[model samples]
Target: MSGSTAGPEALEPLVRAVLAALADGAARRGGPVPAGPPDALAEHVAGEYAAARGEGALSRLTSLLAYGSADPADPLCAAHLHCPPLAVAVAADLAVSALNPSQDSWDQAPAATTLETLLLGEMAELVGYDERAAGVLTSGGTESNLMGLMLARDRVVGRASGRQVELAGVPRRGPRLRVFTSAAAHFSVQRAAALLGLGEDAVVPVAVDRDLRMDPDALAEALDRCADDGGLPVAVVATAGTTDTGVIDPLRACAELAAEHGAWLHVDAAYGGGALLSDRLAPLLDGLALADSVSLDWHKLGWQPVAAGVFLVRRAETYASLARRAVYLNPPDDEEAGYPSLLGLSLRTTRRADAFSIAVTLRTLGREGLGRLVDACHDLARAGAEAVRSHPRLELCSEPELTAFLFRYLPARGPYDPVRTDRINAALRRGLLREGRAVVGRTELPGTGPGRVRLKLTLLNPHATPADVERLLHAVAEAGRAEEAAEEAAGRHTGETGEETP
Candidate 1:
């Protein structure tokens, strides 16, 4: 029996059941993440699938699987960039999938292609790019960075040489291609270099300032030395929001230096690109438009669903370097028909309609609302930092440059033991995860001596209050004390006295 043979009346109950489940899940928001695996639920679904198959109801299996994933509503789910997407975005995502719009070709997805271009225009305008700018919707910041690097490589080596090298598998004609970025820059830059056949060694890590921002002087020195050493300075990557510290590098200075050295400038603003929405912090990214390319993730700060990232270039013709015509895919005839395929400009083909969700999100939450969200997150971060500073056991590393803070638990009196400190901090983090209290991140900073590892909190959740952050900190301190007590008791039993455990 075909699924089309089923009457609408038969599907009404299943639809209602799915909607009810979604509503129940939505109602359980603002709590700690579920601690246990959802395997039991999955097993139940597997049994149901088997039974449904027996009953010839296999058509419903896809819907069942789509609706049955583990709920992220639980509050303890603050581990990564994953968040419960906005309601508007969720609805738009469903519509996008149902339409199955592919932005690769206009014949397949006419509206989707135009929508993506419009959304790209909006994003470029947000980053101060003019109408002459062109961009493509990417999977995420990583893909965007790779696309920008590929363009940089092609531009630096000349278009014809780049094509010959790619097609004929010949060596690049340019000097040893090199890229520069702060040590704190995201790992994607190095990954991009490697993917472009430049190897990891091609990415030179510039020193960062005390606040974790890229040091302009260090960048200049690195570029000059690279040039003098017969290395082709391909591009300089300036990070807007670093992964750990959320630090925005000196963009204006970096842009000026890139221009002076005739190097391509790519700003990885995947995390901090939303700062452009803010009146206060927008100046921090003042020179973003001056870059040859910029990467922005609407999924990060725009509160859109995942896979919402854009790669914008200042010169529209820069993308011509990536343009290639395939007879079966995008024939020359299609080019004259106003049928522009995003495939030529991006690393992806048959891409999703991620831009629709972003468009819906931006339309629902206007520029003012977006700016307010950014400002609110920054304010909440500051409040959290103040809470950490006021706490007796915690120490704020420095004032937050953006909506992130790095701090560690400080011993109240005794001299700091790096080994003991690491154990206590690790224990505190484990306890928090085990107890399902909070999800604070951990990072290691290489110091002059043995280096020190500390806890980091990324304050992207605008709804998170200072009280919530304080509660998490207090939990960390309590966990630290409990671990110390356990260690002391073990030491007493072992007759080790005050000696630190390895």
Candidate 2:
């Protein structure tokens, strides 16, 4: 029997049980995360999927999984891109999943086709693109960046040789194709180059300033180097809200340079796109409008669910490279008959309705509501930095920029040993994860010591207040202090004794 054949009665028990588990989990998540050993959790989960004495087995499974999840939904979670999604967006996602619309062909998803276009248009406008702009819903920043680079390459190689690289493969142009991005830029740009057949060597890392922003002078120098090496500029990928530090590149300056070099400008605002909602923070993206293309991920800072990525281009023709005509999807007769289709302008033919959730979220929160959320995160981050500075164990590496702070801790009384410090910080993170008290992030400062072990605090929780952040810092400091103390005690014990049986 097909799983879908199960009646509502059969599902009712499972539904109620799941809801109950979810309710309990949510309530528990408000306090502390259950940071248990992964191996133990793995054993329980394995048994759940395999064993079958099962009357309320699903309830047992739900409870087990709920416990197993690190529960990043907790406001204490400042680790990575994970966060609790907006309620309105989750509701919209439920409808989307239930309806299950695929917007490739008009007949299959007429409303969704039109709706997604309108949504994309709204997003393009937000990026300061006019009505003529074109965009498509992508999986995330990686896919969006990939799409942008693909188009950028096609426009460069295609215009010169009058041959479609998408159809014929990377044309052997005389000048080697090159891409440029800030040293602080996301690694996705290099990935984009690799995917576009440009190879990783095509990516030129432009130097950044003290604040971790892409230096315009460095970009100019790199472009000149590319020219000197007999290479044509393909794209300059600017970043807004870099993953490690949340630093944004100089957008307007980068755009000017890209135009001067006749290269495509693609802005990756996956984490900082939420700032566009607020007039105050929006200026951070001052030259955003001038870009040839932009990438936005609503799932990151916009509080949407996973995979709310949008790839917007300045003109519809920018997407010509990705277009394809199929008899069943977009035929010649159908085109003439005014039947709309979205089989083109996307890497996937079976794309989900990612726009609906974003639309619902925007409608519910409006621009001001979303802006406040962004501002709150930014303000909280700055405040959190101050707190980190005042903390006994913690130290601020730099001021918070775009809701992210990178810092480290004082593990013990001894002088700073790079290797020992690295070990303490790593152990601190492990201790936190093992205890599941607080979820903070860790990063290594490039070219700093053996490894400049730094903690990353991504303030994405708008609801978290100053006190909440203080608590988070306190927890972090306590963990580090505890680990360092234990290590010191262990060293003392070793010195007192014969230093281990070995």
Candidate 3:
């Protein structure tokens, strides 16, 4: 393992150059994102990664994504909640990367292990849990949720004739275990079921009300039917804030249902966890305390870098399934010596110090500071929804529950045609993306009809105001008109020229 010819000393200049290039590109991104034509976009990306082993190529490579990618930091980039992170988070990330510490064990990462544990405790408190609550840093909502369901599966199987699933496989003699969740719930739950050997079919899609909240009565009836059919109830997954609509399920009612059915309760609050900071928004998480486990992703709402996810459980003892001991790792004598450890907490053996950034962000923003950001985004969503409803061309899809909107543009043309409308809306979104004018998102609106396209605006930029959102909608409308005009021109060309309008 000989050192490179450049040596470590050469990195200082390279790093500085990289940062300067990134900063320059970021500063220049003051306008809408560029949605370029096919050839241009392809060239930009090709030039970015084209040449290899060339001097100063890294600088050009940095500029490729730095300038070409849609800027989530820009208030106009209303696409997703993986928004611009706090500067402190970036700095902390740099420190962690430099230190290269792993929080898996006390000897491996003493400070990181301590910091992660304390931060997990603070996060548990935010979830309205007592001192008994235990948590571990995860990759994101998906891993957090996978472990939660894994725990539920083990417990359910254990209760089923005292089977230990870790040693013995999932019981084959009993009725298959079923997980209940709203249709609007995150897909991670189903994915978790598959990983845990429950099969995707193990999940039961409970209907949601008009507000997209899980219907408690429907869940109750489903649970009753499951019992009658001799189906073993495993867990009830409740969504605190769904990804697409940001809808919150009725947590209290879901908790009650879980209690009555003797099932584990897990709340997927990866997107909505930031509401716990705001007194106003926190109420939406009522009955969260009743959940057996909860997932939170600071990267989504806490203004932190990626991979800042936490999984909290009400009882610390429930994590016994993750416990493992080895002489080289957690030796028997070392455990008795009171050396604090976090090795048995997560699914990873060499976990990064993600909690370092999370701790710094929480301390930097405090609860109120974080809450204000959440409040600002929610206000912007309401304002944007109002703007949509008032606009002649735009129609609000559903009343916003969080900082998100699901709406589509209404063309000023002949009779309403779902197919034509969906096409125009989708084309308009792609046009906007290609031009980099606006980074608006698009999703199917099954509520309206199958294959229907609906424009989405996830207002993650806290500094953005209602006026900014109005301007965004105006931009979207203009793009829609241009897309419609292009479509009409193409149709007319096809009628006259009779050649395929490329």
**What are the clash counts of all predictions, listed in order?**
4, 0, 7
Residue-wise C-alpha lDDT for candidate 1, range 1-502, written one tens digit per residue: 1133464456566557666655554444223532323565567578867777543363455445544543333333344555557778987886786567777777778898888888888888999989999998888889989988888877765542545444444254556778999988889999988888889999999998888789999999999998898877889999999888888988899999998987889999998898998898788788888899999987877777788888999999888767766676688788777777777877777789889998988899888888898897789779888998888888888677677778888654356666667767877776766554566678876445432677887766677677767777787788778777777767622212334443
In TM-score terms, candidate 1 sits at 0.87
lDDT of 3: 0.84
Off by over 4 Å in 2: 1-15, 26-32, 52-57, 492-502
Deviating ranges (above 4 Å) for candidate 3? 1-15, 27-32, 37-43, 52-55, 446-451, 492-502
**Cα error, candidate 2, residue 183 (Å):** 1.4
Question: What CA root-mean-square deviation does each model show from the true structure?
Answer: 4.3, 3.4, 3.7
Candidate 3 lDDT over residue span 1-502, tens digit each: 1124544465577778779888866665545575567688678678668763487688877766677667778777887766788888998897787667887678988888889989999999999999999999999999999999998988877887597887787887878699999988888999999988899999999988877789999999999999999998899999998887898999999999998998999999999888898888899889999999999998887888888999999999888887877577778788789877777888888889999998987888789888998898898899999999999999888777878879999877655666667777888888777767788888764365533688899988888878888888998999889977887777632322223354
For each candidate, the alpha-carbon lDDT, in order, equals: 0.77, 0.82, 0.84
Q: Output the better candidate (1/2) by lDDT.
A: 2
Ranking by TM-score: 3, 2, 1
Cα displacement (Å) at residue 276, model 3: 0.4
| Superposition-based RMSD of candidate 3 using all C-alpha atoms, in angstroms | 3.7
- Candidate 2 lDDT tens digits, 221-322: 989888888889999999988888888899999999999998999999988787898777888889999988899998888988887999899988888888
Error of 2 at 58 (Å): 3.9
Model 1: colliding residue pairs:
31-75, 32-75, 32-76, 33-76
Q: How accurate is candidate 2 locally (lDDT)?
A: 0.82
